[model samples]
Target: MAISDVDLASLLCSKICHDLLSPVGAINNGLELLEGETDPVMRDRCMDLLADSARASADKLKYFRLAFGAAGGFGEEVDPAEARQLIETLIDDSGKITLGWALQNEALPKKAIKILLNLTLIAKEALVRGGSLDVGAEKGDLGIEVVVRAEGAKIALDDAIRSALDGTIASADLSARTAAAWMTRELAVENGGDLRISSPSATELLLGAIVTA
Candidate 1:
């Protein structure tokens, strides 16, 4: 099945909106509660909730802007530190998944950065029961290589996501949930590379990608 540019764009937009809805909705709810409560103590609590929700929403937007939207200006290379910080904040908000980072690049091509972020996102999602996520990337003469490993008491990766990342899923079967995986795979292919997925055990999942500049 073939996906047009418009379809891809719509799917990505839906994915972003779906992921952001929770925190954004919390912000709205906090506002409503704060407006009705007159008690000082309860008001303070509502304010705290609003603050946290706003922060969460902001963090997710930053991550998605780089991972899915155009960020880091029009420069060919993007600073790896920016990507790292976004990933750190995203995982920190979860308070469930621990992140281990080992990016060996001062800067990477924009496409490589997006792929790295998306692959890491997918790996992080595999930790259904809260676990460890390790992300690594390196640039070599051939291209950039990224590896993301997730290990936990229970790792659950939807088969559809696996198919999307491996370029086996038909476009007609794609959904917002799998949009990131599909975009990551397409970006890798566009950059003269491919993605790989492996499940060494039920408790572990590994995702790898190699994309050339």
Candidate 2:
């Protein structure tokens, strides 16, 4: 089933909001506590919480801006370094997920960058027990190849998310949890490419995408 443009936009927006709610809420709560707190140590704790929440919110926004927004600027290609920084900060927030980036290209088309970021997000989700995520991209005659590998004590990818990434899910079944996967597949397909997911072991997940140049 084809999702209407309006519906797709709405779902994507919902996903973004859902991902940001926790940190934003924490920031608000920190502010509220700071306003009423009288003790110096508690006040400092509130400040720390606020700072951490603010940083998290900012990092998520930056990642989403490039992954799902037009903040790619006026360029047809984006610097891979920028995408790296966004993903690094995002994974760093988990404090359990480590990132290994290896991009052979200095710059990649915006579509490819979006696909890379979204795929990274999906792979990170599969790392249920915290893990190492490796992301790599390269341009070739066939097109641009993007790969993400996640390995941890426990890794799991939902069937719905896999269907969404493979473009087999019905529009009515789409949810915030799978929106990024859906969008990642759409981006690849729109550019004459597709995404792949592989699980060679219960503790490892691999995601790959190839977008035509």
Candidate 1 lDDT, 53-171, residue by residue in tens: 99999999989998998885764798888889988897887789988989865888888889888988888887878889998889778788988999999888888898998889976
TM-score of 1: 0.95
lDDT of 2 by residue, 1-213 (tens): 567778777888999999899999999999999999999999999999999999999999889988888894744899898999898898888799998989864878999999989989888988988989999999878899999999999888888888898778876669877777888888898789888888447888889999998
* Cα-based TM-score, every candidate: 0.95, 0.95
Q: List clashing residue pairs in candidate 1.
A: none
RMSD of every candidate to native, in Å, equals 1.3, 1.4
User: lDDT of each model, Cα atoms only?
Assistant: 0.88, 0.88
